[model samples]
Target: MKTYQTGNIRNVVLLGSSKSGKTTLAEAMMFEGKVIDRRGTIEAKNTVSDNTEVEQIYQRSIYSTPLYTEFMDNKLNIIDTPGQDDFVGGVIAGFKVADAGIMIVNATQGVEVGTEIFARYAEQHKMPLVVGVNQLDSEKAAWDTTVDSLKQAFGNKVVPVQFPVAVGPGFDGFVDVLKQKFYRFKDENGTREDLEIPAEYADQAEEYRLALMEAAAQNDEELMEKYFETNDLTFPEMIKGLNLGILAGSVMPVFCLSAKKDIGVKRLMEFVINATPSPAKDVEVTVDGTEVPCDSSKETALFFYRTSVEQHLGEVSYFKVMSGKLTEGMDLVNPVTGAKERVTQIYAVAGKKKEKVSEMMAGDLGCTVKLKTVKTNQTLAVPSVDWEFKSIDFPQSKFRTAIKAKDEKDEEKLGEALNKYSAEDPTIEVLYAKELKQTIISGQGEHHINILKWHLNNVYKLEVELFAPRISYRETITKVATASYRHKKQSGGAGQFGEVHLLIEPFVEGAPQNNRFKIDGKEMVLNIKGKEEYTMDWGGKLEYYNCIVGGAIDARFMPAILKGIMEKMEEGPLTGSYARDIRVYVYDGKMHPVDSNEISFKLASRNAFKEAFRNAGPKIMEPIFNVEILVPSDCMGDVMSDLQNRRAMIEGMSSVKGFEVLKARVPLAELYKYSTTLSSLTSGRATFTMEYAEYSQVPADVQDKLLKAYQEEEGDE
Candidate 1:
């Protein structure tokens, strides 16, 4: 591969809603650039971007892939991204490293929820935005309708540089409105010939051209005055203003193309090469805390945006050399961890394969192989670099499951494999329950977790069982109680002797001044809720208190009492859940100095806690989550009813795109496996997101059942 050095290396990311043909469009560009001899197809398991087994079998992009192309005179590093909502993390990561973006929208569907998601993201980052209306060759592909939708969704700034000349069965190709030229595609074989714009739609094309011109002219006062005076601008002049608008981050250029039919793609290629701003000309920020310009004149602060798992290629990382040159065998500091590692090997990656390279220029994107500690979203801080770019924002994962390896002996290997898998995908969470001894895995949805399972089986050669996660509830006390105990042992020269004298008081607000606890033997005390009174308050009341003046209990032994109380809190006052906020006062107690250390007091405190907790009232608390559900209006009644049954409270509601966005708080226990239920209720059109809200007191009957179940399960274990 030849290094195309023209100060014109443009790295652009391909992003859009799911099923928008982003990967296919990337393949078309590669094919047109002659970077590859043949185009790879998604379903055929041969696409250049969908290379991973998870992606190949799923027939979708699981991660972003970097494809390089030489168009016109500059090198284009096109980062193709997964369009599925669950894998949206990859799409966001792709944007962090690209100077500009090619957001694709299906011609028939126009703008969608996912498209809006990325558009807002691009706008937030001030990235140069470009739109590609793809699949013009397919049936129901209405060019006019898509253009209208774009206008409505994105506003007037989304000016089309070109429009499709036909739609659906009549689809042929696109005509360059400004240049007044049309490209006729030979067929799916991708051969094209230039032609004059049809005379019939000339008048309709004029309307959009004026719209484009007015949009472009607004970017420059001189151009605006010229357009107002003459009511016209030449094609080359319009292109110039549009480029300025793009560089100014005030306008996004929309173009037409068919990825599968290879129509109008060649025009897009020319526009990108000629108009897109080079990396050195775009915005720049520091990786550490120093200011660094986007100039090759200084040492570089290269940042890695993504990584991939390939059977042949070991840990290929897609990175941007922010300010300086990056070459094989050069060392750089990862600003995040302050770790240093050599580049070792530099390569240009296309999905799964790699082409070895010697160096990549500053402000350009390339990949390096076998870096030891680099991870996604990590920035390498070189000297003279000051500020770090904004962190990538990812969506909350909704899918979840608890998983454990099938073979006990494979536990270590399973853990190692899961760590690697989770590193590549930040959307997945791995958890272990110490009590249950189960390793649980969670992801965005059923499909998302299913893909992780597939990787574990195929890549790591590990078998596993996946189950729904069980709710983790905590226990505490609600009342205050006091207990005293004595420990004596006489079998040696120094007999072990200790006594615990403590009043367990319910926690209170004023307890801060009175919260001091004593330890004569084994005991712990906290002025917390539910320990204020001998009666079970299920909250703090501060029922127990004492001022042991004149050292009725030796102050030296106070530490021993605290140790025992700590154990009591951990083991729990009620059914061994856990306890807190109970104040223990050791007014009087005896301890043998030989056996009255922290360890002996810890044992005594455990006994004291059990006795005090039995007298005090203990209770359980369950987690609640704030859930935002967006579903079609027709399903709102069903959703509300279901939420009511789950003891949820509706907080707010709004309407969007024939759907209702409902904000509610529901217990986490009621929300497990909610994705499947929401799919069924909304007929697979509704989506939801949730976050940890708060811990709420469980209802009386529910609490009883949960407690009973916990006791029975503990006994069985």
Candidate 2:
């Protein structure tokens, strides 16, 4: 493979909704460029982009695949990304490396939820966009309606540069509005013959061409003046103005293609190579709090955007040259880990296949095999350079499940496989919730988690089971109470003998410092001497006082009593949940000089604290999560009603972009399997994000049910 300069390289990512023909378009582009002798259909499980076993089984792309095609002495690096929202990490990875985005909209379905999500990401990255209406030959295809929907969703920046001459069955070709010529399909081999526009569609073509000219002229003041004077733009002037507008994000050129039939793909390739921005074209990147241009003459730096474990290749790290050229056998330092890795081989990757490349210039995406310490989002640069690129920020996992190994002997294997998969995909999170005593596996959605399960079962030969994760609840008190306990054992010499009196109360942040209580119908005002308040690490407070003026129990034994109380707090008396926000006052106790050791006082203190807690209005607290849901306006009522049924409090409601945003607070227990339910109710058109809010006391009925269930489980155990 020949190395190209930064000016000759064009990096673009393909993004759209599921079944939008992104992968098929990629196959057509590769076939037209002659990179592959024949295009492989998705149903056949042989497309270059969707080559993985998982993708073959699912019949869709699961990972972002980088493929390069040469046209007109320029190298176009196409990063084909998955369209499902479950694999959003791949789409984000593609955006990080690509200089521009080519969003594919299905002509039949028009705009979808996935399309809206990826479009927002492209806008966030400030990447120029080229919209392609694909699958024009489908029976339900409506080119004009799809274009109208794009304009409504994406604003007035969308302008048609190409229109299908004939759609649905007997679809032949399309007219290039920019070039003012009809490109008739010559054969099934993707060859096109240039011809004059037919008289029947000439008026429609002229109207679209005028609109294209207006859109192009609006980007440049000089072009606007020229257009106003002559009411037209020459071919070269119009192309120049359109390119400038695209780079500025003020104009989006929409093209039409029938990827399945191998029609109109070559023209799309030509537009990408000719009009898309190059790596060296005004791309500003920040390093170490300083902004720098992507110049080939600067110090060498590259960012690893994706990592995966291939069958025979081990670890493959895909990266894009950020500033300078990257050559084979270069010793690059990883600033993230402070480790040095020698790049032994550089390859141009197309799906799983790799072509040996001697060098990759700035802005070009390529892969290096087996970098020992490099991972995704890590920067590899020259040793003398003292700067690093920023890392990509991935979305947090929304769905979680507890996983366990099916075979006891494969526990270690399960852990290793999970860690490997999590490393490859940052969106997958593996955590061991110590409080719940469960291994939680979380990802974007149910499909995302199921894919990991598939890999564990098929790839690593480790079977596993998944279940709902347990919620981390807490226990607390509401009122004050007193309890006494005595421990006496005189069976043998030096038998244990101790007695403890404890006063328990709810700990408030700020309250009056008076100590008053009524015992046996008598009011007593106690003076707190040597009162000490200690804050528990888990949350809550403990106030201990030496109101035992006569020293009923030795001072040295107080530490042992406090330790015992803490132990009980960790495993609460009521549901064994962690107890919090309580004050324990050890006012008086009895001890035997010979038998009352640390063990005796500890046992007496623990039993007394449990008794006091049981009588002091104990309650269970469940965690609350702040959930933000985005759904279509038509489904807003159903979603809101469903949330209310799940014990959710609607905080606020508003509109974001075109979707209705509902903000609510919901209990963690009620939100189990919520992702699945939401998908079913909205037909996979709604999305949501949630984060931990605060803990609140459960209702009386719910608390009773929880206590009963826990007691039954403990009895069974």
- The candidate maximizing lDDT is 2
User: Per-residue alpha-carbon lDDT of model 1 for 209-316, expressed as tens digits?
Assistant: 888899889989999999999999987778788889887777778888789888877788788766777777655544344556667767767777777666776687
CA deviation > 4 Å runs, candidate 2: 281-288, 510-514, 517-548
Provide the lDDT at 331 for model 1: 74
Cα lDDT of candidate 2 equals 0.86
Give the lowest summed-lDDT range of ten residues in model 1: 528-537
TM-score of each: 0.86, 0.95
Worst 10 residues of 2 by lDDT: 282-291
Best by TM-score: 2
Look at candidate 2 and tell me the lDDT of residue 666.
99
